[model samples]
Target: MGFLLVLGPLVTLHELGHYLVGRWCGVRADAFSIGFGKELFGITDKRGTRWKISALPLGGYVQFAGDMNPASQPSEEWLALPEQERAKTFQAQPLWQRALIVAAGPVTNLLIAIGILAAFNFAYGKLNIPPVIALVQEDSAAAKAGLDIGDRVIAVNGDPIESFDELRDIVVPNPGTDVDLTVEREGAQKEYSFTIPTLVEQDRFGNEFQVGRLGVGSSPGEIIAVGPVEAITLAFKQTGDIMVMMVQGVWQIITGRRPVDELGGPIKIAKYSGEQLSLGWRQFVSFAALISINLAFINLLPIPALDGGHLAFYAAEALRRKPASARSQEWAFRLGIAFVLSLMVFVTVNDVISLPIFGS
Candidate 1:
């Protein structure tokens, strides 16, 4: 139920983005589904589109006219359609319109995340912490790096930091990394280089994780209320920052700097959703926002059978002044589907073994 609460509405909205945009572009939709597999039940709307829920509740799709399936591969039957019917087929639309329709799903997820974050900022204000060291742990990274009390951290690796949160964002994911820290002490600015120490920590659920720790403390941060415009602006920055962290994490995993087990699938999402729901509504909603951004990011990857893949094909079409051969597109989509299924299996296995019952 927790998983459904978090994912269902987001998935619905994602498909709705495609459905609405396709309609606006004069493309007819054959079906709107909340999931894949056998249809549990459905209702045909006045416009002749069947809206239904399916057996699988993990994801959803909108099947536009001329689409052979939810992935939006063009149907061979479309070419044989009458002139009037062909006019309403998705494949008959201009390249720009086709691109827009395919892109809408992921873009909507991004907008939802931005709106949720902006609303939180407007309601509860934002954290404002200056990057000044109040204490340095004995024999710790900061101490070994010659950092002392009252040292104001001015930058990390030449990037100016305004708050302690920003400093942590840059440092935490980079365990065992040598970083250049610029600080102001006694009105003099100097730089210090040190390797951030790796620390193993556990959450309330006893899930172990590793993070880089500088072993420095800061004063309690104040919260400043933001105006409506500022709230939205800050939300955008926060979203971008999260995206950067995600990229860094993926890179670390690829480079063997992070564990492969860190990658998760549906089971992990369900577990996380339940855990966050237990914490509080705010935490759960915030998790949803994070997932929304993640969904958008994943869909935009240039893999065949995804929104990004469709867009990639459109780009190719634009460059070559014609669509790719139907045979080529068919093979690419088949390969994409196979790759996605294999990844799902791997992550599901990973999720199961990592459970407490499995002694991870």
Candidate 2:
């Protein structure tokens, strides 16, 4: 129920983008639906748009005028109509307008993420953890470099260290390399230099990688409140940071630094959702935000049977000054469906293997 609640809002927001943009572009939306298949209940709005709640809560759509055909082809009746009559037809719209309408869905997801983060920040304030060294391993890089516990990290090289996250970001990739660390101890501040060891560690999916380690951890700090502007700025920065992490994770998987088992299916998501629900609403919201971002990013990939796929075709049409053949389009769609199904199967297998579902 919690998963559905979170997912429903995200999905509706995404489709709402399409509907709103379509209407703004003078493309009549026949149905602004919250779900798929048979309608449970609906109302025809003043603008003649059928707003519907359907059986499937997983996703939704905005069916446009002149989209009666299965292939969404422009009907002869539409084509034969006067310019004023055809103005509302999606096919009759300029390419840029069509592209904007299509792009709006993903853009809406991003905006939602930003809004959620900003609201959360404003309500709960930002928790800024200072980079104070809490532990140092015996004979490790920090120990050998004469760095003691309780040393507060002020900066790395020339970059100011606001938090441990920032410190980790600067230090993680450059293993076995010297870095300048500005530290504060007692009443005095001094610069301490150290070379991080190439410590090998396994990822969440059990693939190993060598990363820089000074064998020290940081102390946690108290939460501090900020104004609306700072909160929004932090929200955007957090979003960008998450995007960077996602890109790095993908690159790691591609480079065999992480296992493909890290890739999850619906089963994994359900398990995570349940676990996160137990943790409380904040954690659940965070998870949902990350999932929202992932959804937006994945939909933007140039794969067939997706919004990006349609956009790609539109681009090709714009370039060639002609649409692809119907047969070619059909074949591409079929291939895309097959690819998606195969990927689902593979990820499902991974999810099952990773969990104790088959255990007695």
Residue-wise C-alpha lDDT for candidate 2, range 260-318, written one tens digit per residue: 87788777777777777777889888888887887787677677766787788889989
For candidate 2, give the lDDT: 0.80
Candidate 2 has which clashing residue pairs, if any?
none
Q: Which stretches of candidate 1 lie over 4 Å from their true place?
A: 69-75
- Positional deviation of residue 333's Cα in model 1 after best superposition, in angstroms: 1.6
RMSD (Å) per prediction: 1.5, 5.0
Count the clashes in each prediction: 0, 0
Measured by TM-score, how close is model 1 to the native structure?
Answer: 0.96
Best by TM-score: 1
Total clashes for model 1: 0
